[model samples]
Structure formats: structure tokens, C-alpha cells
Target: MADKSTEGFYEVFEVFSKRNEKTDMQYQFSLLAPNHEMALAMAQENFMRREPVIDIWVIKRSDIRKMTEEEKETLKRIDNKDYRLTKGYGYLKKKWREYEQGVLDENEILSWGEDKDATDRKRTTS
Candidate 1:
């Protein structure tokens, strides 16, 4: 059994990380620390000891405002919003074909940012 009064001192901190400059931040894991400074100091050692991380963020769990399942269900997308999706932009492929130009889709466009040598090696192996 632990002291109830001291419980408040150890706050939960959520860790997020970005692998490289071009990558988006992703949730890594969680830890308990007395304060933000201590949490930040411990974050790298605790979560990224063996991994390459470009950036790390430590957020106090109590400070986050999240929606419930019911609140999430309220969010909806209309079929008329097809222009927002890749399927809606499918016509661009045919249009590009007409001009004899390549139409790079989302994955292909993103892959352009990857290391060309690594990509070439993978293609050769495949």
C-alpha cells in the first residue's frame, strides 16, 4: 500500500516521438513523473534508448482533453465530400494518361521523400 496523499505528486506523462524531420509525431508510451521537467529528462532514456528520434514530446496526461466514444460518433462525413478523398481525384490519372505524363498518387508522392538508394535496393531484392 502507498501513501494516498503522495499519489498526486506522481503524474502520468504521455510520450510522443518523431523519427526524422519529415515524419509526423507518433505516440510512443507513458511514464509517471513528479513534474514536466523530470518527465522530459526521463523521456528519452526511458522510451528511446535504442531508437533514433528526431524529437520527443512529454505531455501530462491530466492536461489532455479527449472526447468520449459518443462524441466521436457524432462526427460524420457526407458522400458529397468525395473531392476530399483520393477516389474523387481518380480522374487525374486518366487526365495525366492523356498527356502521357505519370500521375503520382499519395503513396508514390510520399515515397519520393524516402532514400533513393534504399528504395532501389528493395526493388532489386523484390
Candidate 2:
């Protein structure tokens, strides 16, 4: 009998998926597979069993250039930029209501350059 070594038979594949069309593709996990097809099959098998994902992507790990230890350390330092998401500014809604004004939400913000009449119609339809 002859012995065969499988040294570079399989490689790491990073998996990414999203729940629906509107959601962003997030890093799900990683897996080892011999090729892209097998990697995708493994990702689909794992993620599909856990959740209903609208999309799945599997890419060679070597293709991605992740942050180095120093880069990560820099990211962990103090004085990081302050970010206030819409949820963090919920109080503004009440404040604006008190002034008889509506809060400019995502849809309103996106419709800024469009026709006010069209925007109003879209809002009403929604």
C-alpha cells in the first residue's frame, strides 16, 4: 500500500452572509474546503441550517488583508471618534414634536434632493 500526504489539500474560506436584501453582508464564520465550490457548499450547509439567509459568500482567506496586531492596538486606543446613531438621538423626536416639527429620519434624509411632492406621496403610500 502507498501513503499519500494531504498537506495543502484544503484551505481556509471566510464566510459572509446576510438575512435579507436590505441588510449588510456580515462575517458569519470560516471553514476549510478544498475549493471554492466546496467552501460555498459548506457555508450554505452550516448557515442555512441555523438561519434563513438571503445571500452567502465564501472567499479565500489569503485574499483578505486583515488588521495587524499594531493596527488593532491603534484601534483600541482612547479618543476614538464619537458616533451618535439615530437610536441614540431618540430624544430629538420629542424635542422636534414640541416645536411642531417632524424628525428627519432615514427616509426623509434620503429624499432631500428629490421633489417634495414625490417624497410626500411616497411617505403617504408607506
Candidate 3:
């Protein structure tokens, strides 16, 4: 006997779970299900029953758009252009080092947001 509900059961679902408070969610594995509800329940027993899970996401495989082998070939570009990155800006680092100055990194730039005095000074000056 053919079951109509089982026809869609071949649909794949990707399962993910958050292990703890400090860590981000990671992919567990894939499972087959008739619908999202079934997939979620099955995923819990199949993978997360013994482990800690803060959150879960059951995504339908058909809904996901993944790159194909042919498409990946086109995604490749020349790595010779470091001119677009900080590594390309290595000369500036050497220049700053020569003057006994620290290389300006992302942490220093973001720290500017924490400086209320700098913001107030800018507002007063401008």
C-alpha cells in the first residue's frame, strides 16, 4: 500500500543546535521527514537527546540554495590582489613601526566608540 503522506517524507532537513550559553549554534546532521514538525522531533532523539541544546532549527533541504560544482568554478578569483586588504597595507605598518607607533587595528578603531570624550570634543569643535 502506498502512503500519500510518506511521499513527501523523502524531503531532507538540516538540523542545528546551540550547545551552551557561550557558544554559537552548530550543525548536527541531516534527517528525512514528512514535514518540519516530524523532522524536529526525530532530530532530537537521533542527535540531541543526550546533549545540551539551547535552540534548534529544522530547515528543508529543498528550500536551501547551495552552490553546484560548476558554479564553484566561477567563484574562484585571483588571490594576487591583497591590495584590497590589510595585508596589502603591510607597508603602512612598517612605516608606523619605523616611527615607533603601533599599527592601528580593528580593536583600536572600535575603541573609539567607547570614548565619550572624543565624541564630545568632536561635537564641540565641529
Which lDDT values do the candidates have, in the order given? 0.86, 0.83, 0.81
For each candidate in turn, the TM-score is 0.57, 0.49, 0.53
- Local accuracy of candidate 3 as per-residue lDDT tens digits, 1-126: 547867755788999888778888888889888788899889877665577677888899889998999999988884676787777787987787777665577878788876977889899999
**Which 10 residues in a row give candidate 2 its minimum summed lDDT?**
77-86
In the range 38-92, model 2's lDDT, one tens digit per residue, is: 9999998898688999999899999999889988998774863435455666687
Q: What value does the lDDT take at residue 67 in candidate 3? A: 90
Candidates 1 and 2 compared: the better one by TM-score is 1
Q: CA shift at 1, candidate 3, in angstroms?
A: 15
How much does each candidate deviate from the true structure in C-alpha RMSD?
A: 21.5, 19.1, 17.2
Q: After superposition, how far is residue 102 of candidate 1 from its true place, in Å?
A: 30
Clashing pairs in 1: none
lDDT accuracy of residue 71 in candidate 3: 94
The TM-score of candidate 3 is: 0.53
Best-matching candidate per lDDT:
1
Which residue pairs in candidate 2 collide? Answer: none
lDDT of 1 by residue, 1-126 (tens): 658998778999999999999999999888989999999999988656689998999999989999999888878654578887878887987887877655557877667767686888899999
